[model samples]
Target chain A: MTEPTAVIHDIGYRHYDGVRLGRGRATLALGVQSLRGVFGFGRTTRAKIMPLLLMAIMLMPTVVSIGVMALAKQFIMPYPGYAVFMQAVIAVFLAAQSPYLVAPDLRFRVLPLYLSRPLTVTDYVVAKLAALAVALFGLLAVPITIQFVGELLVDLPGPPHTADYLGALGGAVLYAVLLSSVGIALASFTPRRGLGVAVVIAFYMFTAAVSTLFYAVLSSTGRDDVAPWALILNPFFLVDTVQSALFGTAPINDEGYPPGIAACLILLAVIALAVTGVLLRYRKAAS
Target chain B: MTASATPCFATEGLTKRFPRVTALDDLTVAAGTGVTGLVGANGAGKSTLIKILLGLLPPTSGRASVLGLDTATQGLEIRRAVGYMPEHDCLPPDISATEFVVHMAQMSGLPRTAARERAADTLRHVGLDEERYRPMGGYSTGMRQRVKLAQALVHDPRLVFLDEPTNGLDPQGRDDMLALIRRVGTEFGIDVLVTSHLLGELERVCDHVIVIDGGRLLRSSAIREFTRAEQTIAVEVEEGQRRLAERLAALGETVAAQGRLLTVQVSADDPGRTHDAVRDAVCDLGLSLLRLEQRRGRIEDVFKEPVA
Candidate 1:
């Protein structure tokens, strides 16, 4: 006799299984997937090369500053000091490269592949932010370290405090993270990569212009002693403030900190909030 | 024991609405093991359904479950078990197939060593051999399609959704891609949900077929079930001269003459009888029969309306 199971012709048998999984486990799985997309395997070869090229270019200012300090034996340059120079380079690099790294995934529709996997929109945003942060840090770290070595070799006079170096490194990392988060949040608002890049650059330039305007107004009013404290709204200026505070330079403002420490906390909070909002918007748009 | 006893994917009353349009409108479909063809015109919700089933798009209403997991709620779990090849070219230009697929495999939780080994196996399975090491930017459309297919299968998901996998391919590339899709479902035992606007193409490869129009289900059935019904038989003869037609007409074969052939309708239950009668009439009339076969109903036929 033929097997009883072989003769059945029920149509409902074709129905698919309806299994549900835990969100935590799925989130972990997709987070790893997104992280891998950003960091793992051969995908990073281009990412690695681009940053190296950018870092090589960024190193020019640091190398020149070190050379001037070593050979000329003078701190005659009005550009503040080594810490300020390194911070400026980090700021400029973040302003220019952040959009390139984050905007392509949105423009090319690669985000769908990640969304189709076990990853959520927030996980995707975090992965991208992390990638950009790490890349920018890598780019900035190289030149900063080179400058540090140069300073050490030149026996720059100071109390030789380890905390100073650690603090400066921490400040650089914090500034990079904050700027990357802002870049990603801004880029996420538009799908066009050019528009995204333009917006990020414009944001940085606008902040700089406004700070210059405020300083001009203050200087023209015969208030040369008072620095434009409102310049803390610009992240680059904020980093300058933190650098001055750490290096014991003359306070740029009577308050010793422009916008006070409250502004720094607010900037960090605003960056976090902006990231969260963009992530939520992305989730909705993706769905 | 039924062939459909274990469906790889199923959706019930699935719906999706965009800002200006409803991309998917109350769509429901199910597919068992093997390849299922999802055929529809452009903007007919093919991509919408695939996206929903893949957990990329949350349905406006209703539910879709892939590999037995609810797409809306358990989408992450469902995604882990299902692979998807999107229609668009989204691969990074600088990455090679081996690297891309290996990265994807590792993303699916494969250890680094296993991911690399599986990437090679999957790439070879999709016919990307030495070229797997070349950057995807230099790949032809056909080669890119294979790379996308390899990435989908790298993690060994039980079900794979191929959205317009044959789109943008030349005729030969189309044939090769179709053959690969068939093998993915049959030889590899991986369930496949392949979508395309070309109905005639999928009819040849799909075990089951679902047709949608205007974001709604038009028809869903097995490939054979749709085409197995009795239909017109196309008969061609070298020299019938008028006698064969006259004899067949006298014998109550309702024959209609077109340039060099005759079309006769066969009753659903008596197709063989109709064929035998036409053969006998041709033989008796001394006409050399060149061709005689049932005229297969194309998927396009369902789109045409009958006028009263």
Candidate 2:
């Protein structure tokens, strides 16, 4: 038998031959990617519509508040109380948009792809939570910044205005952390975005309704003293309670706000629970 | 192999038991470099073993190591070094392949600029052209598999675990994917642990083959050794094939005539004598020796061998 001739062909396959940045850099990159994912960047146009619309809805109230303040020479929306004024809109935004951060990854079984990378489960959880927190922070900061700039432009009393602006900035950061943790924590459980959105909204709406009902009953029964206990159950009321205590914003509800220490403790507990939930959820094989 | 040269992976009495059933049972094996085909039927613990090696699942007892890194403790390091293409369809539908692969490259610790450039190169290498820009939701099964392969290789891993990559592909698609997998091993020099339930598909590309049955290793050896010549020789004669077979049988040789050819069992005491006897019988009978060939063992023959 004749021997067969051998030939070689170039496939243009090259090795990376680059420095690997390791797990820390990997976690940071995942965080940045998830952050962009939250805003629907690099996703389909249909994916972008929801985040963009919710963002616009989130900004409209601030734009209107800023416009009113500029024209009327009065603070239409208090800086610290802005999240409270648009609590439902902000809640809706968190409920609808936060799932975009995690649910799709879970639904698509892409966790294997990630866990197979240089990242650990804890790193994944941190990256996702950080991304959502940053997105939520950016989401809320825009409105707060608009209001702060409006206050500065209109020359609303310098000392108090600057102090309130700083306080509002701090309050926005707190709100972003708490709300984003809760939203993404819930979203991570389900693979379906619709289910994620529904579960989140149901959670927010149910707790708010229950808190309102319980507080109304207590006030009607002449036990107004205990009404503050009911407001602590709802995240919206919890945020309002904390914001009022933190920035010294006037209470928006008829039931008196919980004391700063009590509100802070409860908010911390909620944040802890949500963050723990995120960690525990990822502790299992996500795929 | 030298003592300094570690196998791609080695397992020692590895066992994994779920709540209801045991998936892997005391599997002890070592896979050397080059393409190693992991052949097992469905539900034979192939995926379970892969998960344990990936450090995604903890084995119930014993230990495993990938690239000399202990799977129990150095899971992240193992993952960092190895790439995996899952058996299922796991691509996100809303995102384009370019964006998704870039994100994965970045997630693998590449900087943004490096990730994008690597993703582009990797996609091109996987045969995804401008169509990489389109969302994966509309991609064909073949395209989706290419996308999956692109993501796995984009990070330039030292080894890759391809679990049933040709699962949903057509015949032509399977051939193309197998060719690509062969290129990955031969051209790129990346060690591969590819799995398939089909017995013969991997015979062409793999240097070694590992066969697992019911979660236990049935055999692990070089493909060439596994398919080594059996103690049998196929003989043909130009004319009087039956007469030649009769003459060979009369010479105290076990012979079975199969139409134009005869299968002679080589004497266990002296295998070379069987070939000599056949030539002598053919020469004496005035019959021309048409063809003489030794039969090689096939993968299917392993199943027929009695379990030890």
Candidate achieving the largest DockQ? 2
RMSD of 1: 8.3
> lDDT by residue for model 1 over A1-287, one digit each (tens)?
86676673522212112332333444454444433433333355665554455567767876875787688754332223333445445555555555655566676667777666666777667666776776665555666567667766776555333444555566557666777888878877876767876788788778777877877787788776564565665676676566555554443344345544655566668677878877786876686
Count of clashes, each model = 6, 0
Each candidate's fnat, listed in order, reads 0.31, 0.85
lDDT tens digits, residue span B1-308, model 1 = 14655477788888788889988888777878788999889999998888878777678899888877777787778888888899998787766888778766655656667777778878877888898888888999999999888888877788899999999999899989999898888777788999998777787788988888888888888887655542678888888547777887888877878788787877567677878889889877888888887665555665663311
- How well does candidate 2 reproduce the true complex, by DockQ? 0.55
Return the TM-score for candidate 1, rounded to 2 decimals.
0.78
lDDT of each: 0.71, 0.84
Docking class of 2: medium
**What pairs collide in candidate 1?**
A13-B4, A14-B4, A17-B68, A18-B68, A19-B68, A19-B69
Q: Which stretches of candidate 2 lie over 4 Å from their true place?
A: A1-11, A157-160, B1-4, B229-300, B306-308
